[model samples]
Target: MKRIPLLLASLLLLAACTAPAPSTASTPAETPAAPVETPADPANAGDVHMLTNRYDGGQYTTCLVPSGSYCVSKIDYAAATAHSMCQIPGCQHTTSDCPVLSAGHLLVDGDTLWYPYIVHSDSEYAYALAAYTDDITPPAHPLFAVTHYQTDLVYSVNVLAADEEYLYFVGNSSYAFGGAGPNGAEAYLFSAEKSTGLQAQRLRLDTLLPGQNAYWTLSAAEGRSLYLQYSLFSDNTSGVYRYDLDTRQCSPLPQLTQNADTLGTPLCSPQVVYDLQQGSITAVDVPTGQSTLLTDTFPTGDSYTYAAASFRDGWVLSYSLWKEQDAFTHQFFRAPDGTLTELPQQMYCDARGTTPVNILDIQNGLVFLQYAYDTVPVSSYDYEGNPYTYDTYLPVYGIIPLQDLLAGSQNYRKLTFD
Candidate 1:
C-alpha cells in the first residue's frame, strides 16, 4: 500500500463525508469444511503498516514482478519459495479472472486473509473490504465483504490492525480521477466491527487530539491500542499519541518527544520507542517513560551520517558513510541479544548496478527485504523539445533466515511467482 501525504484542509467538511453507507451486496459465507483456528489473544498480532508485505504465521504479501500487473503471493518458509495465490488451472494471473490477482495490501489473521479493493460499476466506484480463507483452494472466494460503499469521493483504505471484534484502518479521500473537490484531501481513522456489515465510524480527530493543522500517521499498533505520531505544522511541534481501540480514547504520551532531524523517522513499537540521534540509538520504555541506551557504536565522525532506523523483532540501523568519493548507505542488524552485525549492502545486482535492499518486516524467524532492478529506460520530449529520460524499476522480494542474517551471512533466497 502507498500513502500519499496530503495537507488537511477543512477538517469538518472532510470528516462529515468520510463515512459512506454499507452496500447491499450479500456477504459471502465464511465457514469452510475445515476451519483454521485464529488466536483469540490480540498480543499474537504485531504492528501492521501500509506496506506491500505482511507476515503472520507465513508471509502474505504483494509484489510487482516483470509482468506489469501486481500479483498477490505467499512465501513458504519451509520450502523458501513463493507462488501466486491464484490456483485456477491454466488461468493467466495478470487478468481480473484470476480470483486473487492484484488483491491489495494483505493482512493474515490466523485462518483468514483480509484485503481492501475497489469495485467499479458503470459510473460509480465502491471501496470494498473482503476476506478469504487461507488455504490452497482453487478459485479462492472471499468469505465476506465487510464494508462496501458507493460514494462521490474516491476512497483508499489501508487495513492496519485487526482483533477479534473490530478491524482498525486508516483511510484517505480524494476526488475521483484527480478532480478537485470543494475541500482538499483528508485522512482519518476508522473502525469496523467484524460481525456487523455496516459502514465504518470515523474517529473524530478534532475531539480525539484537539489540535489543528496537524499531520497524523498511524505509526504502530500494540495489543489493543494504536500509536499515532503527529506533527503540528502551526508551531513545528511533534509528539506521539495513543488511541485505545476499546474505549475510543486518545491521549498523548508525555515520555516520547519527536524532534526534527536529518535522520529518518523514529519507530514506536508496543514497548519501546527507538529514536536515533547524533549517531546513537536510544530505546525508551513506553509505560515507565524510562530511557535505555541501546548503542552508540556507529561511526560518528564528520564523514558518516545517520540515515534511518526500523524495528520489527529487532533493530535495523542504516547510516551513510563516504567510501571513495560517493556516499553509500551501510546497514546493521542489532539483535535482541544486543549483538550487532553488519548487513549486506545489496541484495542482488544486474546490468543496472547493485540494488540496495530495504528491511520490509521480520516475522516467523525470517527477514523480508525488498529490492528492485531497473527495466528499459523510456525517453520523451516536452513541447519545447527538451529531452527527458526515465527508468522504471521492478520490485523483487527476498527472504532470509533471521539467524543467518544475524550471523552476518548474505545467504538469501529470491521469491518468484511464475
Candidate 2:
C-alpha cells in the first residue's frame, strides 16, 4: 500500500469522505481483500492499455490503468444524478458507482487512448483509428482523432490489444464462416502505428508452431506479456500460450486450457482460465507449466440450469439459464467454498430483445455489464432501397449494483470510452 502524505491526506480526507464508499463484498467464510485505495486528483499515472460476439470482440480483456487520475472515470448511470466518477484518494471504482464505456473496444496507453474504427473511401471501407493523449483540466479531448492509415485490408478488422507503444490488431478478409482454416483473415497479427503503415508480423510463431488453423484469440495482456489461445499444428494440439512482447518468445500453457472448451477472459489476471462449464477452473503458474484444478469451488452440478463461471479478484461469478425457449436467466456468485448466492430476480430480457445490458464480469460486491451508448448508425437500404438505419449498439461498459440487482433494483450506471 502506498502511503498517503499528511498534507495530501488532509486535503483528501474530506474529499474522500464525500466520495462514494469503496466497493466491498465478503462471503460467509473468508474476509474479502481490502478495496484498492485511490488517490485524489491523481495526475499523469499514464499506464498502458475488445468482442465481436461469436466473432471475438475481446471484451473483458484489458491491462491499462489510468495513472494520471488517482481514480479513473467510472460511472453508475442509473444513479446518474448522485453518482460521481471515482476521483478521491482511497476510492476504487469497482462498484456500480463507476461505469467505463469502451468505444469500439478502446485502449488506454499512458495518457493516450487508442482504438480501431472504419471510414468510407473511394470504393471500400478503410480501417483507421484515433488516440487521445491530452490530459487537461477540462478534458476536451484531442491530441488526435480518427487518423487514417493504410492497412491494405479487404475485410473487417478486429482491434485486439494495445500496449505502451503499439496498437495491435487483425485484418480479416474472409467472407462467411467455415469450420476450418484461413477463416477470412489475411493477417494474424499486425502492429499498427500513428505515423507508419500497418506492419504485419507472422506472430513470430508461424514457423515454430506452424499452425494451419491460425487460431488467434487474445485472452489477456499483462505488462508487455500477452496470453493467447494458440493451437500449434501437430496432433491437433491446442492450449493457452504466453507471448512476451519484450522477448519475442512464445511458450505453451498446458494446464491453462488442457481440457477447456468455453473460455472467458482472465479479466485482471492472466494466470488462470475460467472454464465456462463443467464447474471447473484451470490456473497455470506462468513460470512453470504446472496446472491445477479448482472444481471443488464450483456449484454442485444442477439439472435446473446450465452455468458458466468467471473469476475476478477474489470472487468467481457465474450465471445459469435455460435455452431461449425457456425465457429466463439466473445469476449466481460463488464464494471461496462454492456456496452459491443467487441474485434475487431473473436477468436478461427474454434472451432475444433490445437488451442494452450484457454481463461483462463480476467483482466481490458488483456486476460489470457492457453498457451500450452513443448510438452510431449503420447505413443501409431497406426492401425498396430506402435508407434503413439502426444504432451500431457496441457496449462500452457499465456497472450494476450487486445489492440493487440482488434486491431487485432496475437501475445501474454507465461508463463511456471518451
lDDT at residue 205 of model 2 (Cα atoms): 28
Best by lDDT: 1
**10 residues in a row with least lDDT, candidate 2:** 12-21
Residue-wise C-alpha lDDT for candidate 1, range 1-418, written one tens digit per residue = 1211111122111110111111311111112211223213334334433332345545665556445566566766556566776566776666666555666445566555665555445543455556544443221232223222433333334434566665665544433123324453334565555665333544533211222233444556656677655444333444566776545566667556544332134333332322333457665544345665556776676676664354567777666766677767777777778777877647454554554577777766787777455465778998899999976656666778888876766776876566
Residue-level error in angstroms, candidate 2, position 275? 7.2
TM-score to native of every candidate shown: 0.65, 0.50
Off by over 4 Å in 2: 1-103, 133-163, 170-188, 192-202, 207-212, 231-237, 257-278, 281-316, 319-328, 335-339, 347-400, 404-418
The residue pairs that clash in candidate 1, if any, are: none
Q: Write the per-residue lDDT of candidate 2 for residues 1-418, one digit (tens) a residue.
A: 1111011111111100000011210111111112212111111222223222111212223312332122223232333211222233443434322222122233434344443334444544444444423322112232222212433332223334554335555332221122223322222444544344334342522322111222344545556665554332222334555665554566655455432223233221334444444556555544354655544355333433333444442344444444446534445555546455655443332223433245555555566665443344578999999998775433345567666765666566654332
